[model samples]
Structure formats: C-alpha cells, structure tokens
Target: MRYAYDAQSGQCLKFVYRGYQGNGNGFDSKEECEDQCARSLYDFA
Candidate 1:
C-alpha cells in the first residue's frame, strides 16, 4: 500500500494492491490530516 497526502491543503489518499485509490480534501488542520491517515493505516496491523 502507498499513501500520499497534500501538505498544504491536507488532502489525502490511500492506494492499495492495484485497486482504485481513495482521496479526501479540505482538512481543518495538519493534525487532523495526520490523525486521519494514522487511523486508517492502524487497522492494517
């Protein structure tokens, strides 16, 4: 899996195993962006 996030706008996405990627935009803060991605990835463990 690969993840890419926009640091400026806080848009983020996760791409997995040749499937269609997911994306989001317009976060209120950087902490929110990091938190969202961390939570999403945490389930993989």
Candidate 2:
C-alpha cells in the first residue's frame, strides 16, 4: 500500500513526500537512507 500507520495516527509512513517515492520515501543511496531515516517515520508495517 502507499501508506500505513501504527495503532495511533501519531505515527505514519507515506510512499511519496517532497518529490521522493517508493513503498515509502526512498533515498538516492544507502547513506541518504540512513540520514533520512533519522528524520522520517517508519514504525508502520
């Protein structure tokens, strides 16, 4: 799916944001993934 959330809406994950796209927002490289993961939410499965 393009989106998901935890038990609470307080957490969310999206496939597209600020021009990024994937099963969720993806990085150009692994380093970028590591960096963005810090700022992005990924609690949703």
Candidate 3:
C-alpha cells in the first residue's frame, strides 16, 4: 500500500493499494506519508 499528502497543507490526501495507478505521491506506508508531511511542515517552519 501507499499514501499521498498535500505538501502545502501537510495533510494526508489518500492511499494507493497494490495494482493501481497512483498520483505519484504514494508512500510505502501511512506513517511514512505522515512523516513526510511533518518533515515538509518543519522545513517550511
């Protein structure tokens, strides 16, 4: 599975499972996605 989020908003947008076309923001896990968003937020801060 994978996850996607809004970089500016730092919010999780959606998830992408196996065998599906993702939006390219997909992550390995929800935690990873959230972590990425957090990092992005921190970077902006």
Candidate 4:
C-alpha cells in the first residue's frame, strides 16, 4: 500500500501499489506526503 496527494482535496490518501512503478504525485507514508505536500498548503492559507 501507499499514499498519494490529492490536489483538489489537499490531503494524503492511501491506496494499493500495483506492479512496480511510481505514481509521481505523492507516493509515500501519509505523514511524509503531508509533510512534503499537503501541510504546505495550509501555510499560505
């Protein structure tokens, strides 16, 4: 499983990783995704 960042929702969500590839959005632990992606959204808000 993995997590990805949703741009419209601005959140890190979980999902199953299929095969062997990278989604290129925010594939990582939810905490990492939030720390690296989602949380920053609130900084400007």
- Between prediction 1 and prediction 3, which has the larger TM-score? 3
Which residue pairs in candidate 3 have backbone atoms (N, alpha carbon, C) closer than 3 angstroms, thus clashing?
3-27
Worst 10 residues of 2 by lDDT: 1-10
Task: List ranges where model 3 is wrong by over 4 Å.
Answer: 7-10, 17-24
- C-alpha lDDT score of every prediction, in listed order: 0.55, 0.45, 0.72, 0.75
Prediction RMSDs, each to the true structure: 9.7, 9.0, 3.2, 2.7
Q: Which stretches of candidate 4 lie over 4 Å from their true place?
A: 39-45
Query: How many residue pairs in model 2 have overlapping backbones?
Result: 0
lDDT of 3: 0.72
Poorly placed runs, candidate 2 (over 4 Å): 1-24, 41-45
TM-score per candidate: 0.41, 0.30, 0.56, 0.63
Tens digit per residue, CA lDDT, model 3, 15-40: 54776665657787778888877887
- Structure candidate 2, residue pairs in collision: none
- Decreasing lDDT order of the candidates: 4, 3, 1, 2
User: On residues 1-45, what C-alpha lDDT tens digit does candidate 1 reach at each position?
Assistant: 455565565456543434445446334455665777667767875
